[model samples]
Target: MNSPELQNVPLFAFATAMEFSKVFPEDSSKAESQNQLIPLSGPFQGCFACILGVGILDFSAGLASLLFNCKQTNFKISAVISLGICGAYPDRGLSLLDVVNVSSDRVGDLGCEEQDGSHTLWDKSILGGNCCQAPAVIQKMLVALPQVVGATVNCCTGTATTAVERVKNMGCDVESMEGAACFAICQKFNIPAFQIRAVSNIASTRDKSQWKIEEALEKLHKCICG
Candidate 1:
């Protein structure tokens, strides 16, 4: 079948579990136990739709694919975005409140071990390859945000050293849990997509006290709204 002609493209933004909780307070009446959609008005004008409760790896991937498959006004989504908080490696020069534009993503932890003890998971080339490029419209929209940085990685870097090594290896500016999955889904559907992340903490030793989650989430709201 032919792709539907959409007047306005729908933007799908995904946030982490904690950020989602803050953005959409739990409603007991809703049987799902998690808030899924947070509608916006005014400047967003309903064109921008946020998908919360997408913290789980498989769930997030499935949800994004499901949305893409759903019969909206058009067959293909105008754009898909994952806006949330991520861990930044200090060596990469990213500080809290800095936004990261994901140029690429990969399953950092999904690989098999070789006889030489080297592990290999899906790489950026395998996920979308050179053919996977960010949408021009999304890039234009991001140019207005000066603090935005760019990054790519295959797995989540939770430790300082691991974060640093991955940054050095992949040349990415930040780390998160689900961008690769989002990228994979978009690529599979031939849909245009982008990922923007606000740095909430240093990708160092586990330390919750250092995270600026609330501030990052607020910044994310503003960025997407803008």
Candidate 2:
């Protein structure tokens, strides 16, 4: 019996380089070989539809390639979802292990500054504006998740000063590296896409001593499994 949820959509799951390695550790014997995509079997497999893991820089390109190749390879992919960790803004009152659902994403560092202090980027050139909105289903999922928050960023936002500046500008609940890029790709493909992030640290100052990466990852796994 075909499940309606798995009928056509392929769930694309993305994580940063470090995060990916942590979740999917490499086999020493296969170190030199390309990592192959295997069918993820579990509750998520049935509910997710299709799954693709992507890196930060290659997320958009990878999804496009996956969609194009999957057609030839006899896989039908419909939706994309990313799960990972991010920095939390102090003002949002989010703590370590809290999850965030992105409502939109923006390339915080892409725009060029003008003499008048105005900034602009590709969306401004092509669409006469700059805005990216996530799909409604994703938003609904975010609301359903336990202890979920909203996220945004200006630049990569790893450092204290940078994170503070971004929080002041965007007032987002969290910050991450690849959310905006993933949002851009999903928007282009007209795919229902969403982002889920676990807070590993406060967006204020970059303190390696205070990071709860392992704990956050554990919580994220629980969220996904639940």
Candidate 3:
């Protein structure tokens, strides 16, 4: 909940209440130390948290509303932290539960498809850039974590073909549902955006048995909320 610098308060944004849906003791240290799943607690001291719903539309609306509220209330947000679990691309040297800081994010599925079945991005003259860069200032604060490129997709990659296509299209190491939208919206608001995600599964397959949802959620909680 604390800003990357711990000097200012940030609005921690999430796509959903995935792991933080349960209420529990405010003191999660005891449970966390015992290697248990820590339940939802209060916002970390001196910060705010917002649920941005799921997908880009909900995320954009929630973030815009929050920004508008801040403007009306004269609340200054130091930055925006997009926190969640992500899937790692194959052969990316990434592992499950590895919390990584997204250095940049790009759109995963928006492009112009040609007759040859290839896709191309829009012309760059009219707000056509699909990639959003995370400010270096915020990234410096998270130097301890591995910094990887990310892609924000409306549909999560559930098959090897989809995964390969996404990586080929986006050149991303990890993929999330709301990362680029968070970054782009924050850009419009002149707020630095930071995305941190814990790897949950290989972005290649939809095999539930191979995914580590609960474990990844626990690691995600520890990474950002610990």
Most accurate candidate by TM-score: 3
lDDT of 2 by residue, 1-226 (tens): 2334434644535544445433433322322222233344444344232223343465556666655655566554556677788887776766788876655555545656679665444331111011133333344555665443343334455666666555554455666666665666666656666777788888776678999999887777666555
Segments of candidate 2 deviating more than 4 angstroms: 1-7, 16-36, 46-56, 72-74, 113-141, 146-155
The 0-to-1 C-alpha lDDT of every candidate, in the order given, reads 0.57, 0.55, 0.68
Give the clashing residue pairs of candidate 2, or none.
9-78, 10-50, 10-78, 11-50
lDDT of 3 by residue, 34-84 (tens): 111122335455555566677878888888877766655566677777777
Cα deviation of 14 in candidate 2 (Å)?
Answer: 2.2
Residue 141 displacement in candidate 3 (angstroms): 6.8
TM-score for every candidate vs. truth?
0.72, 0.70, 0.78
Write the number of the candidate with greater TM-score, choosing between 1 and 3.
3
- The residue-level lDDT of candidate 2 at 189 comes to 59
lDDT of 1 by residue, 80-116 (tens): 6666778877766667987656656655555567797
Which segments of model 3 are wrong by more than 4 Å? 1-8, 22-43, 123-141
Cα distance off (Å), candidate 3, residue 224: 2.5
User: Global CA lDDT of candidate 3, please?
Assistant: 0.68
Error of 2 at 173 (Å): 2.2
Please give the distance, in angstroms, between residue 216's alpha carbon in candidate 2 and its true position after superposition. Answer: 0.4
